[model samples]
Target: MPINSSLASLSDMAFGTAFVIYLLAMILSVVFYVKAAGEKPEGAQKFIGMTQSLVWLGIIVHLVSVVTRGLATHRFPFGNLYEYIAMITLFAMVVAAIFMQRREFKPLWPWVLVPVLSLLFLGGKNLYADAAPVVPALQSAWLPIHVSVVASGASIGLISGVASLLYLLRRWQPEGKEKGFFGKLAKPLPGAKRLDLVAYRTAIITVPVFGLGIILGAIWAESAWGRPWNWDPKETFSLITWFLYAAYLHARATSGWQNTKAAWINIVALAAMTFNLFFINLVTSGLHSYAGLN
Candidate 1:
């Protein structure tokens, strides 16, 4: 089916609106951080409420953009890097919305918004593509299943990564005393133990879904290319990242490697996944290269 140019334009406009709303949300969150400093939790309820509202509004708009793009193209929207980034960021925003509803997790919105905005800018400026049907190789029943699972897992992995980074910073700071810039920044975040737990839970969800996505990719490859594995660059990096996450889980459960060590591993896994998403997809030639910037 041909692309619906009208709906395509509407999706683009909605995406732009989502970006603006998210930017506003990030600003409000930062303002909340500043005003809430040295104030009781009860004193800062208004900022939290406003930020959370913007976040939810952004999520709704972002979902409309993704859904309308799919409707316009008559295929899953995440067939290329541009659409994939949008879908992944949408998931990230939804997760952030859920977390921000809790008082303890309210401070995390700005942290999450930075990366989401960065990715959206990257997608809009460098990776934007017109809504259209995917290539023949991507026209399969597994496309939506495989890509959606992978994107969702990746979004959760990002959350886990942010939590680990916050955990490390919080752990490094002296108790009840702010030393410098990093210390003051980490001060508003949840306690290190809570951050570590958040990291662990998010990682647990990421690894299995990510692994399942890989297996589904293999199945799709077998049906499409008449082979189960081709050692594509994306495939290799994805496997490596998966192994890193698995190691993170192992270390988390181990005696000596439970907290700080496992947190470091989780951050590394997130880095690896980010590398695969950009470097392997954009800088390297592979069977998946077609999905790169156009």
Candidate 2:
């Protein structure tokens, strides 16, 4: 059955609007962080509160947009690149919000989130197609579960990468001295060890989910395409990314590779994941060719 074309477009427009609002919230967050760095904690807290409220508002709007799109399309909406980016960004926001609630890592929100939110909007604008409807191959019930889990794991990996970047920027500076763009920025950032631990925790929690996503993906592939392993570019890169994190986990558990070195590994793993997600989709062709811009 064909989807409701008008409704699908409306949902996309709504999501775009929400994404713009999210970008604005990120700007406010940056302002707050800058002010806080200058010792104006009161004003910073107010702005941060306002930013948080706006983030929640954006979340609600995005949720409505995605749910409506799924309903209108009458499919899982993970069939194309635009929808996948939307879902991935949403998952990242959720993870960030959760971490902010528990950790003192709120300072990293703007630098980490704004780029992702912007990319999601760009992807939606350039990659989204009309709800052309899904084929029989995508009608399986496992589609949503598999895609959602994988997206969640990717979100955690992204946040871990951001934290690792911040750690490196801080660690490279001389003790009690700040230099360079990142070094100047690091004055207000959390301690290097703290940032590394945050990255470590995020990666550790995500490893199991990442493993599950790959396993479930293999199961789905076997069911849908009659093969459990295809050695596609995306698949190969994803396995590499998985192994990178697995090594990190093992090093943390055995060799005392804490702090800067662990952070560097996180950055490397994230780079691989980013290559798999963006470069592989654009420059390479494979079973994952559905990721092309429309």
Candidate 3:
């Protein structure tokens, strides 16, 4: 079937609207974080309800945007980088929403929102593609399964990475005083121990999910390319990402590496993931370069 141009336009409009809402939520969350770090804890608490409502609203609109795009294209919505980012941000927002409701994790809301907003902006400005059928390479049944699982893992990895980064910042603070820019940022977030735990627990989930995604991708690759592992840029970076996360988990559970070392490892894995998304997909020519960005 041909693309439903009407629905496609609606989806774009909804996506823009959702982006605005999420941007507002991020701004408010930042305000809350700032106020909480200062002398006005009560003022910070006031923004909590409003920010929460905006997040829920954004998630609903984001879901509509994804669904309408799928309807318009008559296939999975992640046939291109633009749609893939949409789906990834949608899942990230849902996970961030759940975390924001937890007392210990609420203060980290803005950190998570920054990456999501950045990706949304990049998608809208640089990677926007027309509603069309999936490419021949991605027309198989595995597209939905493999892409969705990988996107889901990436979403969770965002949260996990932010937590680990904050853990380092918190640990670096002086014994009694928050002295620097990073210190102030970390001071508003949960304590170092809690942040470490959050990173570890989330990594516990991220490793397996990400590994499974790689396996599924390999299976799909075998069907489409007559080989399971062709060492494509995306595939190679994905393997590196998987190994880094696995190492982070192992370090987290070990005796001497549980805190700073594990946190560093998780942060490195996230960097690898981001590199794969942008540098590998957008810059390198490979089997997975059909990002619709050119």
Candidate 1 residue-wise lDDT at 60: 92
Estimate every model's Cα lDDT from 0 to 1.
Answer: 0.88, 0.79, 0.89
Model 1 lDDT tens row, 72-161:
998889789999999999998887677557788888888899999999999988999888788888889999999999898899999999
Which residue runs of candidate 2 sit more than 4 Å off their true CA positions?
39-42, 174-176, 292-294
Candidate 2 lDDT over 157-266, as tens digits, reads 98888888888887876436877665557766777788778888999977999889998989988988899989988888888999898777776666666656666677
The C-alpha RMSD in Å for every predicted model, in order, reads 1.4, 2.0, 1.3
Looking at candidate 3, the ten consecutive residues that score lowest on lDDT are 174-183
| Candidate 2 residue pairs in backbone clash | none
Residue-level lDDT of model 3, residues 54-124, one tens digit each, is 98999999999999999999899989999999998998889878866887678887888888999999999
Superior candidate under TM-score, 2 versus 3: 3
By lDDT, the best candidate is: 3
Each candidate's TM vs. the true structure? 0.96, 0.92, 0.97
Clashes of 3: 0
Judging by TM-score, tell me the better candidate of 1 and 2: 1
